[model samples]
Target: MAEVSLQNLEKVYPNGFQAIYDLNLDIANGEFLVLVGPSGCGKSTALRMVAGLETITSGTLTIAGEPMNDVEPKDRNVAMVFQNYALYPHLDVARNIGFALRLSGMPKAEIETKVGEAARILELESLLHNKPAQLSGGQRQRVAMGRAIVRDPAVFLMDEPLSNLDAKLRVQMRAEIARLHRRLAATTLYVTHDQVEAMTMGDRVAVIRDGVLQQTDEPSALYDSPDNVFVAGFIGAPAMNLRRGHLRSVDGDWTIQLGHNRLPLADSVLTERPALAGYDGAELVVGIRPEAMEDASLSDNNAPRIVVDAELTEALGSDMLVHFYLDAAAVDTGDPDVLDDLEDAALMIARVDPRSPVRSGSRIELTVDTKRFHFFDPKTNLAIRS
Candidate 1:
């Protein structure tokens, strides 16, 4: 296995459209790093650059301490699994898996041995004789993975390999891929637009936007301490609820003004975020994840709680998603890709237990985990605290 590193990587097309900008990242040997973002966010472009499928406009890419700017894709010793199962229609599963070895002129016995091992690992031993046309979508994807596995390349580049499968199969394949990574321990760079996949499959995730690198870190760290408004709003499942509010000192206590409501800031919050002092009299964006808020009836006195009017209610089996509105200005970060399908109505969703009897249009009390509240500067859109 080999480590991959990109330093100041950039990709500018002939038409003057910049696809990537000043991107720098390093994937350790045997590490699984996921590149995740919205569509047209330069994720796939960056992956292609590393795979030698696209040219690098201005940057250096190194694999195992050697520069690979002019190396051919095959000579780079990398295996790529595309979204579509690129299998030969005429070949059966066994022949398809061992096709690379066959082209390299390996003995038939060695090819069969390697193909058998790969099929056993992918649980495709029973379907080794089926053709691509006869296999299920999931089975076809496994065949594609088996083909890559038989190559035994130093690095594996997968671009949304699970997008074509159904939801249930996607989840199943997700676990299978994770298990396969553990068994092979090959350095991998996976690109996908799904945040859920990124969170679950990656040892580390890099979030990109508008052809720019926003943040790269552990999945939980990115969720708990986002570096900017874009990341804070993008990483979570229900997405973060951002509202414009003013920070002020009321009777020697720092509090945030949400329209007519004033929520006092905890002492720990002020101590951790010294930058918040500068916005004492100015507006800032306050972010809270849906899972961080709970029904007041189920909360203790030590937690920070807020009262709001519920606008809508969704009864998910395990939990309830409560939507509420406040009289704050709508949040618009100016990124059309991020804001395109967003709701015009400013709403907050609270994930509460199904046991809670809160209803729509009711004045409900919600508790905010004050320790987890995030503050972002409106001008820079970056988090006040690290």
Candidate 2:
């Protein structure tokens, strides 16, 4: 395993389209870093650049402290698992996994030994003789992983490897991959559009948008304190509820006015984020996480409370997602996935206790953890925290 570093890496197509900007990242030895973003966000392009499959327009790429900008893909000492599995139909599982070793003229006995070890590691020993047509989608992807595992390269690169599988299989494979990474402890760079995968599997996640690097941090930190509106809205499952509101000071106290409703801001909020005081009388984006809101009837927490009519309700066993319409207009965070959601500008979602008896069109009182609320500049879209 080796450390990989991208120092101001860049990629531009022949058609004068820049696929990636000046992006810089460092993956420590044996660390699994995931580059994640939406469709056409240059995540795949960035991974390809690291794999040497795509040319770097500028900057430097180094593995194990050695520069590899001009190295060919085969000589880069990196193994890549593509999205398609890319296994030959005629070859059995063992042969397919050992094909790279065979190309390098490894003896048949040694090749068998390596293939056997990888097969055992992947639990594919029972299907060593089976062809691709005889294997399930998850098994086929395992074969693809086996092919890379036998190489024992300095680094591993995977590009949207779970996208081809069914939803259930994808979740299963995700767990398998996480376990594999823990056992192998290889320096791996994975690319995916799914935030769940990024949050669950990676030691750290790098979020990109429109060829520009947005934010890179651990999942919890990124969720708790996003640097900008884009990162705040992009990293969560239901995404953060972002709405435009005015911060006003009334009688020596600050309060956020969302359309017609007003919520008193605690003095501790200003004490923590002193910069927020400068936004008095200005419109800023307020981000409310769904999980931070709960059914006011269930608990007696000291959090602020609000009452709204539930527009929709989805029960997921563990929790109930109550969708309601607020008076404030939703803020556009420049995320394409949430564009359609903004059609109803006032829609907001809250995740409440499953035991709460709330249904669609029912008026429910929701409590919000106001101290945990995120505030962002309306013009710059950057978070306002000191």
Candidate 3:
């Protein structure tokens, strides 16, 4: 296993299209790092650069403290698992897994031993003799992974490897891959557009947007304390609710004015966020997570509360997602990448208990965990309260 580091990495095409801009990141040895963003956000390009498949326009890339800018892909000692599971239809599973070793003229006995071990680990021992035509989609993907595992490379690069699988199989393979990482402890850099996969699979996640590195941190930290508006809205399931509101000082108390309602700020919120005190009478973007907003019955009165008419309700077995709109003008946090979606713009979802009796068009009181509220500067879109 080896640590991968990128210092001021950049990728500019001859046609003048810039795919990545000053991307600086470090993947620790044996760490599973995920690079996630929306489509065409330069995630795959970054991974390809690290794999030595794309030439760097500027900056340096180091693997295990060695400069690899001029290294060939084959000499980089990296294994890549592609999304399409590029397996040969004519080759059986055993031969497919040992193809790399075979090309290197490894002994037949050693090739068989390594292939057998990888097959057993992936639970494909029974299908070793079957060709790609005989295997299921999931099985073929496993074969691709088996091929990578046999190489024992310094780094593992997986580019949307689970995109072809069905939903159920995708979840299953996610767990399996996590287990494989724990067992092998291989340095891995996974690229995907799926935020859920980024959150659940990676030990650390780097969020990119418009070819720019926005934020990189652990899943929980990224979700809980996003560095900017784009990250705050992109990392969560229902995403964070962001609306434009003015902070006003009324009778020595700081309160937020939203439409016709005013919600008082908690003492803890002001105590922890001193910068918020300066924003009095200033417009700011307020972010509230679905989990942070609860039904009136589940609300603790000490926290800030907002009462709105439920626009829609979706009962997803595990929890209820209550969607509603506020009367206030929506904040233009300047993160076009996140707020560009109309569906996310018109509605704010609150995760509630399945047993909650809230329904569409009904007036429901929701509490915003004041301590968890995320404040962002309306102009810069950067989080004000860390």
Q: Which is the leading candidate under lDDT?
A: 2
Encode model 2's per-residue lDDT on 100-160: one tens digit a residue. 9999999999999999999999999999999999999999999999999999998999999
Off by over 4 Å in 1: 302-304, 333-338, 342-345
State the C-alpha lDDT per candidate.
0.89, 0.92, 0.90
Could you report the Cα RMSD, in angstroms, for every candidate shown?
1.6, 1.1, 1.5
TM-score of candidate 1 to 2 decimals: 0.96
Clashing residue pairs in all predictions, respectively, total 0, 0, 0
Q: Per-residue CA lDDT of candidate 1, range 1-386, in tens? A: 99999999999989999999999999999999999988899998999999999999989999998999889988888999999868999999999999999999999999999999999999999999999999999999999999999999999999999999999999999999999999999999999989999999999999999889999999999998899988887888677888899999877689888777787888888888887888889999988788888888986656767898888888998989999987776577544554775663377789987777898988899987767788888988988983
Q: 1 or 2: which has the higher lDDT?
A: 2
Model 1 clashing residue pairs (backbone): none
Where is model 3 more than 4 Å wrong at Cα? Answer: 332-340
Best by TM-score: 2
lDDT per residue (tens digit) for residues 268-368 in model 3: 78888888988988999889888887887765566677788889999898898999887767665445665687676867789987778898888888887
Using TM-score as the measure, what is the rank order of every candidate, best first?
Answer: 2, 3, 1
Candidate 3, pairs of clashing residues: none
Each candidate's TM vs. the true structure?
Answer: 0.96, 0.98, 0.96
